[model samples]
Target: MTTALLLIDVQKAWDDPSWGVRSTPGAEANVARLLAGFRAAGRPVLHVRHASANPASPLHPDQPGHGFKPEAAPRPGEPVFTKSVHAAFLGTGLEDHLRAHGITGLVIAGITTHLCVSSTARLGANLGFAVTVVSDASSALSLDDGEGGRIPAETAHRVALAELRGQFAAVQTTDEVLAGL
Candidate 1:
């Protein structure tokens, strides 16, 4: 099975100290490791960026900060999938792109463990792709209410991972995925 690595949302907006770091947990390191591996392997790396409807938001297409992080920028020949929703498959030609390249297996790795990572993995499985989620390659950001109560990002991440493992994809650590590759 030919596999492609789906590196989702390793964008500057998500890595910003002001807007993103406040909520994003352990994302920087996870993505860093994945990027390094992809580089060494010279594999296909598709960077999926989320385009927000909010004009002034950081993820706006024209925003420089909305672009991929410098460390993980797509190489000259890499494909980039831009979309408006959590799942890169929504209205995007990502699935078609994968098929065009004869990629039947998807190695998913990215930020926002409970959101985009989970969403994409589940959809990839439904779309009939062999999918595996790199456990250390994703992260969950914290959430809070007006009352100052916060939900720990790690706690939410673990719960979501448990749900994703047996259903959507295999929950393999970066080492596990790379060791066999």
Candidate 2:
């Protein structure tokens, strides 16, 4: 099966302190490892950049933070799909591109595990792609639990992976994914 590496929103915006505490401090390293593996194997490497619609957000196109982080930056021939929302597949020609490339499986990794990473994995699975989410290659920031309670970043990351584990995608660690690659 042909599998491509899909990196979602691994941008400088994620480093903004306004995001509060985040989990998986080493995620960028894992992402870099995955990128290297994909490049070495001659597999496709796709990138999704989130351009926040809100001007105040660090991810706004006008902000320097909108640029991709070095570890996840797209190389010359790699395709980059820019989106304004959480799901990489929405409003981005990502699905069409994958289809055009005859890509049947996707190995997903990147920032905000509870949001973009999870959303993309679910949508990819629903769209009939075999999706594998690299648990250690994604990070998550703490969030308000809606009742004034705070959800720790690690907890949020774990829950998100658990939710996608069986139903949406195969959730594996970076080592497992690298070994498979």
Candidate 3:
């Protein structure tokens, strides 16, 4: 079975502190490791960059944050899919590309674990792809839970991973995935 690495929204905007403290402090390093592993294994690598339409947002097209973080930047020949929405497949043609390339499985990692990463993974599962989410290679930001209390980033990240496990993905760590590959 062919597998591809899907790195989503690992952009410079995540470095901006205005978004608040994020979970998975080692996420970037782990993502870099996953990238290196995928390249070494001669596996396909796809990137999803989030571009906010809102001019005031850090991820707006005119902002530097719209570009990828150095550690997760795509190489010259790698495909980069840009999207304005949360799910990578929404308007990106990512699923089509994967199908065209005969990719039957996906290893996903990225920033905002509870958002883009989770959305993409769930969609992938529903589309019949074998999905594995790298826990250490994804991060999430803490946000108001709507009741005036803040949900810690770590909690959100863990909960998202848990939700994806078994149902949407097989959650694994960087080391575990690399060693298996």
TM-score for candidate 1, please give it. Answer: 0.88
- Off by more than 4 A, model 1: 17-26, 144-148
Candidate 2 structure quality by residue, lDDT tens digits, 158-177 = 99999999999999888998
Comparing 1 with 2 on lDDT, the higher-scoring candidate is 2
TM per candidate comes to 0.88, 0.98, 0.99
- Model 1 CA lDDT for position 96: 91
lDDT value, residue 97 of candidate 2? 95
Candidate 1 residue lDDT tens string, 114-162: 8888899999999999889887777777767469896777776787789
For candidate 2, the 10 contiguous residues with the lowest summed lDDT are 172-181
Ranking under TM-score, best-scoring first? 3, 2, 1
Ranking by lDDT: 3, 2, 1
Number of colliding residue pairs in model 1:
1
TM accuracy, model 3? 0.99
lDDT of 3 by residue, 1-181 (tens): 9999999999999888899999999999999999999999899999999999999899998999999999998999999999999989899899899999999999999988999999999999999999999999999999799999999999999999999999999999999999977
Q: How many residue pairs clash in each candidate?
A: 1, 0, 0
